[model samples]
Target chain A: MSEKHHIIQVWFFVGVLLLVYGFLILASGLAEWSHPPDIVLAELHAPVWWGALMLVLGLIYCIKFLPDRKA
Target chain B: MTAMMAWTVPTTLVHLSAVDLGIIAFYFALVLGIGFYLKRFANTGEDFFLAGREMTAWVAGLAFVSANLGSLELLGWAGSAYQYGILAAHWYWIGAIPAMVFLGIVMMPFYYISKTHSVPGYLQLRYGSATSALSAVTFAIMTILMSGVNMYAMAVVMKVVLGWNINFSIWVSSLTVGIYVASGGLFSAIFNEVLQFFLIWFGALLIPILGLIETGGWKGMVARIQQNFPGQDYTHAWSTLGRFQDNPMGMHWTGIVFGLGAVQAMGYWTTDFLVVQRVLSAKDIRSAKMAPIIGSFFKMAVPLIVILPGLLGLAVLPMHLVPASSLQPGQYSYNEVLPLMLARYCGPGLLGLGITALVAGFMAGMAGNVSAFATVWTYDIYRPFLRKTAPDQHYVSMGRWCTLIGLIVSIGTAYLAMGFASIMDYVQALFGFFIAPLFGTVLLGMLWKRVSRAAGFCGLLAGTLSSVTMFTLMKLDHRWVAIFALSPKAQGLAQDMYQALWACVTCVVVTVLVTLVTKPRPDEELKGLVYALTEVAQEGHTSFLHRPLFWGITALVILAVLQIIFW
Candidate 1:
């Protein structure tokens, strides 16, 4: 019998990438929350919000495009 | 304010922390992994050059748009927005959207059905080998040179922003792109481009979003721009196009509509192999047709990210920005707007992502150009001319080898550009010489049944020669610009437009005149290549929603609405 080969989707790769970046960024944001960096609108905590958004999006992509999952 | 002023002072505008470097390292590692993983599939010539022709519409579509969305384009257009105001949006909207739509609905069928490996391959089928050879050589040279220019530009950008050594930036990035692209061919390039697309959005979308918040939305931004640059129409797109001198871009409505929107955009989207190669990888006719339509949607939205940042910078930045030639110690140049905005807003982890996005864009751009160059060099030039009887595997190996060679040549070109920055301008002008006339020749060859092969070659030659002559004269004597541009006050942009228009006109005139005297190919011989001789493939009883034309029209409707909204 021929072995079945599974090709990974580009989105899966992107998901993993974004997820890793998100985690790192979110952790950085949390560490800086007590005393934010001196930047324009740093009070808004853009890293925290944007990083969380990226994490959620990445999670969604990773789930939807998992290698074993059927479309 | 110190960070905001970093662009002018420039002691390495921003430094990446450990986490930031991690993000960039992660990006490079992932792309290389994908490239190595895809290597097994790229076994044959077609697979290497065309990604096995199994890409879905969305895959090919994102790749198509992302291939053109290189870092140079992003920074250049964003900087244009600062220099020329809202008028820069014209390049995104009227200049790109319509051509993309037309390519999907009209041109893609011929390109797809012909089953050509590259744009020059299509020319060979339509206009004979002589014409194809010219385009192949020109395209191969142009792409390699363009790739080198982009490499040098990216190195300089990194040096200015991060205090990285130019040679270190150049070698490291080029090696990454070279390794990935050489291993996986078009597949690696396309996948990286798709990822780069998302990274660009994630990294850059914040600039406009935060800028809007700071400036209190679109109306506030426009008001602030008016206050900053009084008596100038920085916020108006089409209104300033009434007179050449009325706008900062110094362009007329006719030039915008005809020269850029009609000729240049059409030539690029419909004919340029760098972008078209992405579309050509779609799995089927329908997907191929749909790819550019999908790209058009993203192309239309690009202005929001690129153009909006420039407007935002004008609305809010504290430092006075001047043109590069007039830049002083305290003032930043227009080219530094995007980097300045990144420094002003992004911190730590987010800074890494921003820098990664720029690096990804640069690598993807280089990969795209090099891959396209390799394809042309292997299939169109090397295979056809040097070794026509090579096995498919041999050609695939040749393609891989050419990728490394192209990168080496590009690295050299980058140094040439660094030594003589004006050479970059000349290379760009050289590119412009071929685009309009090639569009004319290809448009005629595909549409008009009477365009003989000889006429095609002669027309292309005449058009190219005329363009070169015109550019040379304009360079030698400034007075020639007035005659070509139809007004003494016509600026550089206007001169480019009129020059393209004239070259296209010259091409068409020579083509018709020569076709009248030459022996036209019979309809039997011309089948599947010309519009009238070829039976067009119907998108075939798919749902109305699934039709490429339906979405193409939808894109056009949105385009019209955008023009009205931004009018």
Candidate 2:
């Protein structure tokens, strides 16, 4: 458990960073792609997908190795 | 959020939103914070230099490959893809996988057991002092030069993308990279590298994904590129391996297989300290061996991130964005491929992320080179001759100070790199001149105990000189073409490939000849250093799936399938 705690911190820190940036990009990408001032057909946009990736990765680290969960 | 946001090709603002700027700013702050956070823990030479030598397989493995995921591997190969089409994938596959797997299964045991501080240190132990000294000096210079090249390349990207001052970009990136690397040594740099690795993937991922989607898919992209650039072999790897002129790279299969795969790439993956230092810091021999194997898997897929953008550029980009480059052996302004794709595909916030990825890549490269330069300088150059029997802390201070000195030297070299047309060509020539010969000596020194100390020294020196002479003569071939029957000023991968082959051949021949005349080092003195004299490294006989040999063969098989399929 202690071993996991020590290793988890680095991943957690990176995860938090990614999630913060990722969520923002996702929100913005969704806003831009879905509600653009000029309406366009929905397609696989880069920012939205990439942002979701970060969000999921961030959630994994934050959930699995959350500070409260530290052994 | 705007009324009707019209978009054109971005030259200055880079299409990055305010949120994007904040994201990038936060990343830089976190990186610096990590450096300072680890500073106090790095009091000892070992901690500062080797991450306290308690790293797990994952740490060492990621660091092993991430340290190499530098600006050159990112931008240089992408640029190559733009010019050479799918032929550029060879560098990532055949050029890397074999040597890397070989290093894991065969060489990691010696490297791990010896406890040598640096690659040159091993040469000292095996061959003799003179060989080590020569290698140390040469490596120290090469490492700094590489860092400077990264600095220059990054500055060019910044200037092109953001219209920032080149000097300002160089100084800021170099100083930032130097501070963290000097502060936490390999530890900080490597941890950040793991982070950089993720960021690089996340950042560069958009280009190919969005590109493929926009172009329909792989088949659609191939068809579009064929339609756009008719009569060009733009989508094959192995089929183009027939001859030099068959491929766009003007390189033959022999050059690809022997020169790049055998000599240039092998020299870098197996012998270069920049990558080896990461492997050396592993916790156990298995981890050390497994690190490169794991890295080889990653290495095989790297072309997707770096090369795919250039290929995508062929299909999607308009005529003006993809300029025709007059640069030798290449016919495209592929350097712009990454930035152009980033600007085109990434809308707002992702643009910042993409740009940050590019920045992180360059910074990671700089840190890799500087950290390696610092290690080689302190252990090989400073401790050996400058100040002997110094306190651990004293050497640690020397390392930190030397990190600064290495950066200053790199700044000067950054200016020199600005003069080159293709940075990869220049770097490969350096590998040929320095690394190929060094690999020759190391390969022989490890495999054959009969290789005398004098022979190792003479061979390394002869190898370096011979490579330089070949490069010089290759350049001057245009003048004396009729007399020497020489090919003139070989460009792209072709000229460098042939040059490296000749140099490696000369190095091996000279080393063998010199070794034959000299007395062999006795078996008693060669323990743990020479393969024949040392105890065989069993790797404890793991399962078929777990064995390094198994993974190696699997990797080669996958490579063969990819080649035939792509061909």
Candidate 3:
């Protein structure tokens, strides 16, 4: 049982990785908010939208599968 | 196919921003981290090859689907959608769904209950060593060659899309995949594949979403297709398949049904060890059965991302894309549809994510193939043929070494692919030679107890040789498609279908004929491997929702609805 506890679930790692990526992308989105890149539908701000979506997803995973939580 | 596409684009498509590079770097770091973290657990041969058989249905199922979601398939099918219209969805639907359901409900029990480490290992139990040896060597060669093709293809795509040098892209990706797979084995590959499943979905999903938003809706897109290419039924799946000239793919309904839906699909989803190894890692018999059923659901949804983008490209791209045959300097081919779609809608950070998704796809594809090769090499080829009495630790060490050596061979093949582009087409066709024939052999071995050992080997040999002969004839004279496919106008895709169907038919015929003359394996020796002779574990009052059959039926119903809707 202790040996089982030593193994990290794949979801937890996915969560943490998503969280870091989400933060960086979200920051990039905000940084370019006033002057968005010249491309199709720049006004819609897809980076911000997709970045926030990733953030919420990451938080849900991280909270539910926190490494130290009792199984 | 993307593998057969010659890289002729002189100009780079897009340059990655620092944020984009960072996202890709983080993904690499995380995969490597997972591999090192799992190194302690992969100490035994079982753990290395099969993840200690402890994966949940969902994990195994996602990895199972993701193993085939290579960038080559994604890009190729997406490009095919652009070129062939909604008909390309047939590959995702009828070409896949039935085979997956059959695998889960009918085949998984035999594989799981027998406790076989690999598909060839199962063959060894049913037939004698000759059949298993043929299967193992063919599978190993196919996987290694395929891994190389994917490695080279990814490097070419990177150079075309991101301005990276081909050698740099090849070495970086191959070395990364090699390190992780060698260190953590199947566990690392599965974990990364599951992650890749998410990356592919999230990264590619926006195209369809944003594309739909731009094109209005399904109805609007259909209208645009009709408006753009008038009188061309690019929006219907089955309606245009009535005649050879009716559809862009130049395929008939019979080829679509028997060749693709029945033979090729069964051959691939049911028997390919590259994907089957994931299901073999399930925690229980139920999980093993449930895995492919779960995978079918996700596979059905892939067209929303892959096929939809290509259709959108047809409806919305500013310039007309040419086919690869007529492609020239500075001209974009249909194969560039996905990357072009990525550039059209994605901005800085999101662009990075999309590019990383493609990179993840390529790397994960290479990892899955290499890992499967290592398992087949260590267990089926190396141990059985060369050193039969080695310790478990010795085998595990050999698996790791084999993983590295396999990557080196794959890298060499990648260079070979660079020199001779036509080899990719031949290799892909050679792969086709095995799948449908092997499916026939495995199916007979499982269902028919009277089949002899000699019958299995002879049937497989005859089937493979016939496929080779047909491919060679078709290459030597294009008119051979008329003879093999029974139509003068049958295209390359049609030739593939007819070839697979004939090969499967030839195999079944030869096996039955040989079985009559040869001595059969005794019933006592065929217990767990053959169908009715085996004692299957009962589910024992399990809820209907918990049963694999229930989900299999549900998936089939959904598949029927999808075909009708797209029809």
Instruction: List the DockQ of the predictions in order.
Output: 0.49, 0.37, 0.51
**Ranked by lDDT, top first:** 3, 1, 2
lDDT of 3 at A42: 78
lDDT tens digits, residue span B1-567, model 3? 122223434566666677987898899999999999989988888899999888889989999999999876667678778877887788788889999999998898899998999999999889878888899998888888788777766875676677666777777788889999999999999989988888888789989988888889888888888888787777889988889999877889999899989998899899999999999999889899999999999999999989999999888888777665677777677767888888888888888888888888988889999999999988888878899997899999999998989988887776654443222233436556988899999999999999999999999889988998998899799889889987877766677888999998999999999999999988989999999798887876999989989999999999999989888
Report the C-alpha displacement of residue B18, candidate 3, in angstroms: 1.5
Residue pairs with colliding backbones in model 1 are none
Task: Flag the better candidate by lDDT, 1 or 2.
Answer: 1
- TM-score for model 1? 0.95
Candidate with best lDDT? 3
TM-score chain B for all models.
Answer: 0.95, 0.94, 0.95
Docking quality of model 1: it rates as acceptable
**What is the C-alpha lDDT profile of model 2 across B105-138, one tens digit per residue?**
8888898788887899899899877899899999
Q: Candidate 1 — what's its lDDT?
A: 0.84
Model 1 C-alpha lDDT per residue in residues B1-567, reported as the tens digit of each score: 224323342477788788888898889889888989988878888788998888889999999999988876767677778878888788788889999998988888888888899889988988888999988888887788778777866765676578676767778789899899989999899999999999999999999999999888999999999998888888888877888889887788988898878887787888889999999999888899999999999999998888899888888888867665565666666767888888889999999898899899989999999999999999888888899997888998888998998988888876654443122233436555888888899999989999999999999889888888988888788899878877666665566777777888888999999999999998888788888977776756789899999999999999999988888
Worst 10 residues of 1 chain B by lDDT: B1-10
Cα distance off (Å), candidate 2, residue A4: 14
Calculate candidate 3's fnat.
0.47
Q: Where does model 3 sit among the CAPRI classes?
A: medium
